[model samples]
Target: MSLVELIAQADERGLAAAGVSCLDRCVPLLGGDDEVLRPLWASLAEDGDGWGERVAKIRGHACDAATGAGAEAVSGPRSGPGAEAEAALLARRMLAAVPAERSAGALREWADTCSVAALDIHRLLDVADDGNTSVTDCREGRTEGMPPLVTAELRRQVTVLELLAGHGAAGVRQALEVSAEGRRVLQAVVSRRARGRT
Candidate 1:
């Protein structure tokens, strides 16, 4: 199936296949348009009109990938090219792109909310070989009622992705100006990654 098809299936079949909350979660991750991932994402978003089945396949495939099933998780019908898979791939790609500090916050406040309509994304996103992130990261180390990982860089990245994907506000320009806090967070991720390389 495809992402669009999976969306329709959710609408038609209820949770027997994919739950409503599951769909809500993936929307935020699906929206980001970093220069690194835009070209790849554009292809998924533009899989032609009436491309429902195509989308369903993507979601199923993505779910499979998350479960470590490789790409053979959900197979049946080609769907509309790889638009759904591409969207799914781009979502994971950008997720990997996130600055570590902000991942927990973005997932908690916006992406993981019931509003996004996809909980599976959060489940997969929650899975980190690095450590028990996602939900716990948002909970365990909160400071002043704020998540320790919710740095300015994470917020900016979330904002940028939300805006670019047209999932937030009336415009996307909000995420572009960038912020001092965001810059510092990104620098920190880069610095940390650099150190790990050595």
Candidate 2:
């Protein structure tokens, strides 16, 4: 099913998972450890009821990580200090994209916005781009300028949301696997960007 159709059919839990998974996978953009959002994923997987609390905690952690507060220092090097600020802004957008109520409307909004936001984060860190083509072009019709890794991440985000929307709770595992794949792709992107700085 298409992403719109699947989202229309998803239940509350499925919708929530769709949004959470997207944000969870994008954690690396904030220079956060990969496991930072694991608790939120665990909550969804086990049907635990503390989603709000988890979201709050994650927001705090994102803030700390952005400011280099109590959070762990990201191990690899950075593209530059400005890259962190751009990444942090994108991470904040992901967090804010989520809504308080676990309704289909909220999830749809979050899912759509988060998908674009995640791509924007990748574009911000894509230092290789020489401005001949923009991410906006990729969304339009020009995919040649976009990196394969970023393309894969965008595809995964859409797939996860579509799966949840189509299959609801029954599709959670598959959706998560898709999200995990995206996370791995973004991790590689992050690593490459860091290495290029050296």
lDDT of 2: 0.65
Stretches > 4 Å off in candidate 1: 1-34, 37-110, 113-148, 153-170, 178-184
For 59-139, candidate 1 gives per-residue lDDT tens digits of 444444454312223333222223233335434543332222222233333232321222222222221213233433332
C-alpha RMSD between model 1 and the true structure: 14.5
**Taking the tens digit of each residue's C-alpha lDDT, what string does model 2 give over 28-111?**
766667777776667666665777777788777776775652133334333464655566566677776667555568777786
Tell me the whole-model lDDT of each prediction, alpha carbons only. 0.31, 0.65
Steric clashes per prediction:
24, 1
Question: What's the TM-score of every candidate structure?
Answer: 0.27, 0.73
